[model samples]
Target: MQNRSPSRRTVLTCATAVAAGAAGVVGVTAGPAVAQRRDSRLKNILARMSIEAKIGQLFVPYFYGASATSPSRLDQERNLEELGVRTVAELIAKYHIGGVIYFSGWTNNIHDPHQIAELSNGVQRASLALPTPVPSLISIDQEHGVNVRIGSGATQLPGAMALGAGRSLSDARTAARISGTELAALGIHQNFAPVADVNVNPANPIINIRSFGADPRAVGRMVAAQVTGYQRSGVVACAKHFPGHGDTGEDSHTGLPVITHTREEWERIDAPPFKAAIAAGVDSIMTAHLQVPALDPSNEPATLSPAILRGVLRDELGFDGVIVTDALNMQGVRTKYGDDRVPVLALKAGADQLLFPPDIGVAYNGVLAAVRTGEITEGRLDESVLRVLRLKDKAGLLSGSPYASRREVDRVVGARGHRLTAARIAERTTTLLVNEGGALPLRGRQRRLLVVGASPAFPTDDTRTTVPELARAFDGLGFRTTRLATGREPDSAKIDEAVAAARGRDAVVVTTDNVDAASPQRTLVSRLLATGVPVVHLAVRNPYDIAHLGDVPASLASYCWTEVELHAAARVIAGRVEPCGRLPVPVQRADDPDKVLFRSGHGLSYGTV
Candidate 1:
């Protein structure tokens, strides 16, 4: 044997070089079996595809309702035939289009998941019947919890913040697994969910309830568990708003949101959850239209920035997955770069899929022109195509898996098990912020009880479920309830007057609607506290409102103004349920707020006797 292992120095140097190269190649390569399968699939599909069909595959358009009022209405039956759905079967029959993402507005009725599934199946079946084989990548935003779109038959799980408050990774995983199982049962292979954004900004308008919590580690752990659960249930979970949209103050739906943090902060706070999700094998990553000047000096949003998506996420974070864009029609991209040009820019910027494009034809043509002009190479397109096909294959679409039946859809979407899970979460997440003199668990036969807040009416916003409905859950709980509204600070004097009127009454429950703006409502809380009335402060918004109340007898932080929280609050106040909710975010001091207020584990508990 002529020293087959070689000298120590030579071996060490070669091993180090190989390690470095392997790290670099991780996200770039498709691997041996994956590459071979991709090559074979691509060749088989491409041989039957026309130039138009190939171009169509490059553009994944948004399909709105059948009306012309909306952006694009897929004349599915016609488009399927034209795209060569009349030809072969596998995945690429007529159009090699990567995927289709369903939204609420696209359906005949937003509440009807069955109707949506029927329409979706119709399209998928058409694709299957095509002469040239092509399987469809059907996707939807089924992020159970707050951002639920498919509502009618779907389980309404607590929001991400609620899950964070539960302090259980298992809770997050179960929520995702159940949601994924339900979505899969409805023929939805992809879920644009388990938002990996680490919510660091309290002023983040859009991502508040959508984010799990402010802590990167907690968010990361939850995301990993959720992604694993979804994948295990045979649904492709996409960790979204990549490179993190957690620190922005503005909503991307309205305009471009910017994060002014340094790269170090970005990696530490914002990127950890995404890193965790990627490590946990998230099938896809959805890019946000956010401007992080420190990460990409080009001033372009992450969705259209190769620096953030290709360099940071794919390279630095080592994520080898599909990179899908948020709705291209949104103002975040449309205002900065015109609607017509965003598709080409997104593709050139390394986005594998363009979601909800305003004009599919224009986008398709633009990408084709870019490839022809050498802006986006054929190799790049192939890479994206391969990734799309691989995901479809993993989803069992490539093998012509049978569509989920209506009974199966119903069994999973709003099953008894999922609802019970939601109820359990609701029971656990209700928190009590203040209880002085032990005024809570109000004793027997209280003659009068007052409830005060905004309008005392149901929230008119379609997005929110009402609070009064939940308050009704405590109808026979040994107290007569009175509802009132403390309109403004000047109204606080009126509230004081009302409290004086109800003096010697059993208890005064002053419901405070904590708006984003800091108002003079602190005076009202102080007045109630001064009177020695058993004051119970109920915050409908941020839990930080607790810091304003000076030694109130009893206080509760509902986090949300929804009906579920309202009912849960009633039970907690009535001593029917213990306050098990931990603070998801810090409750900072009103006068001198700390960067991090109450730590993650701060929660009140009323144990069973």
Candidate 2:
């Protein structure tokens, strides 16, 4: 399953000019027109501020400040208590931190709509207590699907890849708007979303299912849509993982991934979506922790590479927006430097805001020391503070108390209309990959059906393959259904149990998630296909499952196993809705690279030849 090329090495590699650009680092200087438009109010405030407050503004640390004493699983995993600070008020007042990013552990154990609103208000009120009264840029990864951090009281719209499968620009816009609308209602100003990675390599461990698609133009179109959607609703949309994280097999969370494409290839494959995002006037761009030697030969990551961040993104792409780094706590950056040193390197590399530094006190002190020693110049720090302040001003945080009312949070978060919009996107994105001999549109209510469940087939999957809910959706359609659940791949005993149950059934429905990655799931499906009953295969994760299970009479992909998506899949199965979704990524035959089972944009229509 590992799809790395040995030719692509771990060390930074690039051409002469590209390497020279890294050394020269030419984009930090602002042009005359840009300088002319600088906010006079912000400049005056910056001139008056002390170094402590200025350094604080540059760090956006994560907060584990909910009153719940019992730590959630994420809290235990991240060791949130080790950071020392407890409440938002305490952290903001002490560090005078510029902003806060909320992770689920903050309130998962005791998350009420009113409590969340109160927490957000408290954070802002603490910021208001500061000398300059700079309201924090309250941010979350409300990216709407799998990447979402706040899910309980929010609209569960399909993720970026699902929208890509639907292939409707309007749907993409709607998803973003709904996410923005809901987050703004929660008093959150920034959303780290609309993953701009092109997902060129299917073997990519992280960006898959999050990215829009493999094609550059398609990703560009969706990225622009999401940005417009979020910003139009007053939520700052942060396009992420710049230049790109699409082609690497390594997950930057655990290890540093090196993207080995040449500068020409980088521009051709990875940079287009970011270009489109910048042109669309995105509010911020988050740097990836991975290394792109083509953009910088100094062996530094994109987060700490001036050539990639300033020369390419800021100067060449002309993006004057706030440049934020991906979480500083992630091992991608942490492995190279200690908590104290990372902030200085990130700032020196042209990053405006240091996000999620593991130790806020250390990171803050590090930046302050760097400023005093002239490692980070006063003017350079001002440039970033100016951009961050401008974004806050645009969000209307500078004018008054930036707090969400409990009444508004109750009314706007997960509103009925917003839920419908999410459902519609899910319905539209249910792709029908293969339907041989017209095996779908199962009729005859009296006929019995067999439903079998398999665990998610991801090469490294932790998510469950939702079965009972899917079976219930089918049962509601009046099929005399019998449900059976098995491990990702059944033991011989379970397979025997399934085969015996399939004998009298009129049709068989198998639910799978990422079967191509798990050999056991493939074996189970192939065995069931041997049965004489018509087999309907539903792939719940990656669409590549269909290319592997080609012999199944009918195959469908719902992208993810969310309730809305499973409901939409049921409608398609029962002939209540037509199959309209196309493939976002190609279904390449692993055995035959030249033979693609299904191309991108290929899908079947109901009752069509």
Candidate 3:
């Protein structure tokens, strides 16, 4: 799954004047009169747009393939006629799409930096060739850490909670700036990142490690810093799932979750980070596909609720920027409105951008028909399209040249300096949660070092693949290590094998992700502890596994399972680096749900190991 080029080297290749606009660097410097002229031009463009074209300007859809003339996945999925067009280039030209979102893997829209740069230029060229020539904004979800979409050759910085654990706003800013710089270089104008949801509920299925932490102030500080870093780096930063998607146990991608926060409580927990992002001049705020009865009593999804989007987010929070709807195809937003009405309702709800409708044609016609029938006013339609144009102008897309330098991709992206910064950030994110009887830091041991690894269940992965890399991480440090991959979740056979393998080892390290008290991972760790062998339980996703496992001999939370993060964890175990990361959220006592086993900001360090 590495995004390789024609050559077998890394995927970081592509270059020249990026976002914020210098070559691949975005620079939009305008005074009052300059701003006035830019707005005048965009307004003029809007005035000339036909009702059909104007509606298209409000939609940002994703298409399959790496070129203008390739096959499609969505066309087959929908069995629709409009999507029958060949290649994403055709989709853009045919629909006059205002924006395009790129995804790697299944969509195959991106492969390497060069391929992505070509696609960026190709799509932009297609849009500009139109008689009216509306430049489309290119965007992606390069959130870094576990939620990353773009792979290597890009700096994979620590996730939000990991940065929160580091407690350094400067590092946070640097990480975002580096990530933004590379993404902009690839011609991606918008980055759906810096998750602003305050993760108050540990059972929060989606936002756990994606959010900074539970504390309002901490989340706000990191969110504001990241937003500034991203904008300053020339990529438009979007603070998302507004009003809060942090407290709900259900994930909105599959199910509609309701947040019952009172207006006062919402202002306390969920509002601060968004307020901070707005203060920092975030370009957009994405609406959550969930219900907030406290904000809108009608119980409509936030994406379709005028009370929440127009009332709270617009009037109360004062975010004059573009409000983009979360994927309209998701069940959360689709359940209440049919395909035709969803796009129209989002505009009515104050969303300036309609993202990923099931069918782009259906969405376009829906909004167009709504305008013709007076269900939605032209004035309302004008507001959203104008905001989109302004965003384009802000990204220097309207000025000229949306193409990324194919040659420059290699030098600017995943450069040595960026990799070092990522490594340092990873080093600062290793939170030592438990260390009983000094069981960790197995240095210079005579016996072979035994390892039992398991992958996190949240993001599906096989620990067996990472075993060689893990062994190499320790082997590079001059230690003889034996490794075993017990799958993501171990059965009786794997556990028995792991216990048997640990008989004469210095220490046993097992990686856990969201494991529970009754889970097989708990049984594995307990068996390893009973064998008179030191055991280290590593929680690679959420730190809450320690609380659930209850009284493990030793535990550490890397907060993610990235190569750099795992290497940092290995260094800490070998006494190479001190674990400075504190708990971003409180770890509750398994026996008592009301009481905490380890309070927030708790971290253990080995002295003179």
Candidate 4:
């Protein structure tokens, strides 16, 4: 194996490499007039495309293989059959489907970078065989920190909240650049990321740690930097869930969320980050499945509202790039419209691309029928097709060979330098919120330590736990460690069992996950604190756990459950690394009514004490 770990000098060299590569990624820049003239090729291509091809350009359907257990060699053939095509080339020749979104279910081999690159090449070859030879725009949800749709061949960075706490615009750029370069190496063209939503609502179940932080200005700046970084690395950067999904309590995956803010209120709070994203030259913006009566009086979600998608996003914001809908299969859109009607409504509502339509065949036929019956005008359809073609042209899909080599993919994806960048961000963002009685650094002669709480696991990852890795770190420090978890809130018997386990321990270290919402976990921590043992609580998920912990002598927030973050927390405990991270999001105690326990931007350094 290669030495895998790089020194600081090597990391800086990687940063400079990114800076050099960025200048060539989004290389084409011309004034509005020159840009319009450049679209003549796109227009000529559109003039040649048949009605079926034009309609196909508007739809991006998802493809998942028949089973996850299928071998890699059989996947393309199996997927073709499942997609109702005899061969890969027939997908374009027959249905003329514009693009296919790859889900993990698409193949068991989805995580292999070499395999992914080969798949991209195969798809491109199929597209090239068509009469028009227009290459497909291969895309993925490579949103890091959270929702990494690609795995095994990618670096797992700490989530958006960690980046918020890291608090460096340059770090934001470097992180995005690293993510985009790996994606491009895998022959992926678009990254649906750098979530622009300002996470103001702590109760928001979905966008919690995925968002940068609660402050609008900070979110705007960070997402703007990410947009620049991604586009400069040759991947289309999509700022999503516009105008914003930050404050809503509902998950759009299950139901259509309603945001009741007025137009002025939206401008003040929800609209700033999106505005910044557009200003940063974002290539695409994904519409939210949200209903804002203030923007559009109709009950329809933004995905189907012309007033929101066209009037607000396009006319007001002056965005001329591709407009994509959030996955149409989600209940947010599916519940309102039938399979056939969803794509038609989205296109009419100004979406340039219909992503993840439930049934590609039905959606394609429905769009073709609408255009022929005058339900959708030919001119209207052409406008979106032209925009799609322009984007494809800008991405160099029309001009250059859209194939990546396996060797390059191996060299770039999750390379040592990129891993180092992720580690540095993880190290810097682990915030220390409370140390009431000099309880951290484990300075005492206590040789026995008890570790308790939730198993360390990221919200996006379910395979491994950070507990064993964390235990080994403590073991390396010469502390005899005991690990315990009741799996749920302990009853009398379970509590007695835990108390027995804690009897001989000198100090207790508890790792918390979502304790703000998990009352049983909260109660368990309080009970442990009452034992008069020095309990040092490490919150491994949401930082709001500090609110529930309530002066537990010592508490730290990791904002993630990844190994890099866990190891960083262990180093903080062992006094090898100082805890210098500040809180990016505020914490409010349920017992206190008037004040925040720890304000946003508040962090403590060991040297300061």
- Candidate whose lDDT is highest: 3
lDDT of each: 0.67, 0.77, 0.79, 0.76
lDDT of 4: 0.76
- Model 1 lDDT tens row, 1-609: 010222333222112211123221112234687567555755666556555555555555544442212222354443343332321122233345556666664333244657655645554554545444354677877765445567655666666777777778887888778777777777778888888897766667888767878889989998898888787777888898988898888999999888898989987898889989988888799999889998999889889998988888888888778889998878888877766678878877888877877665556767777878888777777777767756665665554343556767666778898878766766677777666666777777654776655323322235433334444555656567765555545375676666674576677676665543366567666666677657777776566666666666677766665555566777788888788888777666666766444565577665521
- By the lDDT metric, which is better: model 1 or model 2? 2
Instruction: Point out the worst 10-residue segment of candidate 3 by lDDT.
Output: 7-16
lDDT by residue for model 4 (324-380), tens? 899987888877789899889998899999898766777888988999999999899
The predicted structure with the larger lDDT, 1 or 3, is: 3
* TM-score of each model, in listed order: 0.81, 0.89, 0.92, 0.89
Name model 3 segments beyond 4 Å from true: 1-33, 71-82, 456-466
Sort by TM-score, top down from the best: 3, 4, 2, 1
Question: Which pairs of residues have clashing backbones in candidate 4?
Answer: 145-159
* lDDT: worst 10-residue window of model 2: 8-17
Q: 1-609 in candidate 2: lDDT tens per residue?
A: 111121211111111121212211111233465444436656766776688988888888766645323244565444446556555576777887778887674434225556666667667667766776666888888775456666566778888888999999999988888888778777788888879999878778889888888899999999999888888777888999998999999999899999999999998999999999988888899999998888899979889888988899889999988899999988898777888998898888889989988788888888999999999899898999998877776665554446677777778988999998888888899889888878887876426888886744221123434676677788787777888887666787888888888888998888876665455677678778888888889987788777676578888988777667777898888888898998888878967857788999988977773
Every model's Cα RMSD, please?
10.6, 10.2, 5.2, 6.4
Steric clash pairs (candidate 2): none
lDDT tens string, model 3, 1-609?
A: 122222111111111112333322232445677657666767777877777777878888877777654445563343235465666667777777888888766566766777777777777767765556776788888777678777745767888999989989999999999988888778788999889999999889988999899898899999989988887887888998897899999988899999989989999999999999988888899999999998899999999999999899999888888998988889889887789999888898889989988888788888888999999888888888888877776776654556677656777888899999888888898888888777777756633677676754222223324555566677887777888878667899998998899987877778876787667878887888889877778888888988877567788998887777788888887778888998888888788879988899999888622
Deviation in angstroms for 542 in model 1? 2.6
Off by over 4 Å in 1: 1-35, 58-60, 66-98, 105-109, 129-133, 444-451, 454-465, 476-514, 517-533, 548-551, 561-566, 595-597, 607-609
